[model samples]
Target: MTGEAEQQLRAYVEYFRDLGVREFYRRGEPVFAVETVAPAVAVASALFAAPEPVAERPIVARKPDFLEPPIANPVSFDQLAPLPKSRVPASEKAAALLAVQQEIGDCTRCPLAYAGRRKIVFGDGNPNARLMFVGEGPGADEDTQGLPFVGKAGQLLNNMIAAMGLKREEVYIANIVKCRPPNNRVPEPAEAGVCTQFLLQQMDIVQPEVVVALGATAALYLLGVKRSLSSLRGHWHTCRGAKLAVTYHPAFLLRDPRQKGEAWKDLQMVMAEMGLKAPAKG
Candidate 1:
């Protein structure tokens, strides 16, 4: 057989292997058998050993009788229930938050722990800083490095802080959850709930003068309400005595450059509260 034909046969065998058709031995004799439709065998043989390669055959996937499109239910804002609350009080919540870190040390609470390398990203920057930045969660780089906002998004955040005439070390930065979500996807509601106390305790410790919700998740967690960032941005909401503001996360800004103008506006609002002037656009 030609090199191309041999390669084709190898691919065919691999595909059969994937479908659980393995070689077997019976009475000290080896045999390869595949239980497939007669038509499929012809197609496989043609692709694998034809003297002249033929055009690719169309593939049709079999659908199960029970396979139907999901039904869409009309959901009303009022019908949505509030998230379940943690019964722990402020003090106990703080202690439990610390304990979770100590107990889980390099946690695997979620499936994200298995992908690539990661370390438990607790948080960093002034534990007592009067200003805080809360992101949704870590990304690939942050997960591998075991730190929050250390990638390009992080640099943009640092620049945002510096625009307010403050350094990253001067303000506290954290996420809603300690560990990253797999494939950098958003955390499920239950996962967020599991990690909520840690963020709450971080707030309790820092007691920031202003809390900046870097995205919708952070804003929703702090305000206990579901609203678009547009409606929440450039305004101050009170959270446990600290003024809360919502803005597009640096990561979001990176994806949607158009929103950076509005983010800058939100940052100016925060700076105004701190008695600082917004940096002029060069």
Candidate 2:
């Protein structure tokens, strides 16, 4: 085969590998004129290029179920349940939130409950907050403190709220999942599926006027569609009766500080909609 053809075959193999499509099966004997090429590359080449019929019988092998990526049809928050017939009265929002927390007492509803979780981080911040921030999940600091966003990411989130001319106490902060996943990894769909039911209830009670999804994972579960974050940003979406916006997670901004400006842009959009003004430099 030509060098260009060989290079094309390698790219296909890498692309599939990145998608977790490992263990490709050979359909027929190698069709390439060169016998020196490896068997795996030969199979890839045939799949990529038009095939000339060969004498060997076709072989089909099913990829193992264990190797498959986790699949879930996440239900959007709006469709999870009908909104309450009447909004919880603001005078009793705090007690209603506390009742939801008590309902989750010593919970073992999901695998994350047993995944070395030190505490179930229910939520924190104003019960009557007009703004809410939803993050992916807890980390070591959050798990230890049993409150959302108390770590470095939390510190950065506090700054993000401050930038919006609001104190952290003025906004409700929670996560897609209350418990920290093992090693701060993204929560599995099954895990998030179970936990977000509570989050939905929390949002219903707090009734924030605007909700900010702090990362792709939070956006995925909140919006129930897996689109790029950029597409979801700079637009208005509704969730549980509030306008929604997507932005970079503080953890991500910490890793790539340059994007902090972009995150600020997202927050500024929220601020403008809410008629908020940042504090003057003094």
Candidate 3:
């Protein structure tokens, strides 16, 4: 190996050794791809997303209590009416949504804009969708692509949408913060504060029948109250004239696969409110 490559390999070995990993798994000359990689899979958006726990701060994924029954309120979507003053024309939704994007042009509204973010992940999917999914913020992939939920977490969301018998293009998706927080950490209150109005405006345009808050950040911000994911979950809440439901973030599900069943249950509540049934098995 070259001197630089050798040095990097030694540093990697030392770092793992610090983690108490004693043995090396090398059996032969390792193949390293020196070529540039253009990742397309939604899950591959995590450029800085750590696969292993850090020595100082380790993450502990959990298995939720699946036995907890999902809240099943058979609410109808058509019955939902936008608050009187918030009157928005459904026919002009696409134009209105685009107008909001133009208003957010090259946003530097918060420190998040200056924090190494390449692009603003405004929102994606249908502008007139009956269902909208709001996540915490962008990831490495999202920052690179300038779209929400374009990484691995996004792929899981695509499956979730399919399970609801809906196409990816039929639903709107967005985040609590338009920019990716450093290291994918939860967005600060200040960031969410300045950016939330944009989301609210988008909701007004879309007029979705259901809104799914993915994880704590989305749920807390949407509900305007602090509560545990467990407490916020398994029930219907109202936000911006739509029935809101809370669920685990897909990135959290990637880390803790066991909780997917629970997230699905949260989604089912959304589906039920929309009078949706899952697609056929075959």
Candidate 4:
């Protein structure tokens, strides 16, 4: 077979593996039983089949691979790296962020403006924060409060912060898109693109020593590439001059409490780099 045909066959084999055709063996099945095997048409269909739809998200070209494993510790902050030793002067950060917000005044830059958004959530927390958290977008509660991560998920985030030996106010927070997508859907790429400069500006102002992207959307936009959370998580990347870390959004943890441990593991890496220890249980 030509190289192209071999590549095609390899892709088919991988798809079948995803569909649990692992053993390809049964007590009565023939070792070379072409008749018993899934037909070529079936394999082709599997190759073209659409991925499962996520609620509240539109069908884009291909489903966003929110679950990717791109690299294996490409550049682990394996040990504490010098942090917060240099950053935007604390006195100047608040005014810088405020300037970005003023520029975003009553934004009609996208359809979200007419989507019944309550207030534009610029960001919240200490302007001079050494650490910052970025998430997908404002949800219902954040929409109402004009703040990021203020709902039940925010509560969980609060716990995560306390566990990190810090409070919510001690760290800066923002989102990929400032306005809430209707019904809490992921921000479409176009919408996020329009708002990218605002977010980038926010990061520049705070100039955080370290940043944690709170979900796949935040990770995708910050890194300026289509990457799976798996690829970005537990690793560090440089973003607008700050050490970037990726972790699960607190909302995800609320949905799958079991993954909280995994999320903590991701944060502990940040803790180590920042020279933090979990508060002693009182």
lDDT of each: 0.67, 0.83, 0.75, 0.76
Clashing residue pairs, backbone N/CA/C < 3 A, model 3 = 42-151, 42-152, 43-151, 43-152, 45-141
Q: Candidates ranked by lDDT, best first?
A: 2, 4, 3, 1
Candidate 3 wrong stretches, greater than 4 Å: 1-86
lDDT of model number 2: 0.83
On a 0 to 1 TM-score scale, where does candidate 3 land against the true structure?
Answer: 0.70
- State the displacement of the C-alpha of residue 249, model 4, in Å, after optimal TM-score superposition: 0.8
Model 2: clashing residue pairs?
A: none
| Cand. 2 TM to true fold | 0.75
- Candidate 2 runs further than 4 Å off: 1-71
Residue pairs clashing in model 1 are: 130-209
Question: Across residues 1-282, which tens digit of lDDT does each residue of candidate 3 receive?
Answer: 966455445533443333221121112221222222323342233323454434443333222222234323312222233454855777788888899999999875555665668999989988779999999999999999999998999999999999999999999999989988767777766677668878888887887888998998888777776678999899998888888999999999999999989988898888888999999898
- For residues 164-201, write the lDDT of model 1, one tens digit per residue: 98888988888987777655666555556556666666
Clashes of 1: 1
Worst 10 contiguous positions by lDDT, candidate 1: 70-79
lDDT of 2 by residue, 193-219 (tens): 778889999999999999999999999
Better structure of 3 and 4 per TM-score: 3
The root-mean-square deviation over C-alpha atoms between each candidate and the true structure, in angstroms, is: 14.2, 13.6, 17.9, 17.7
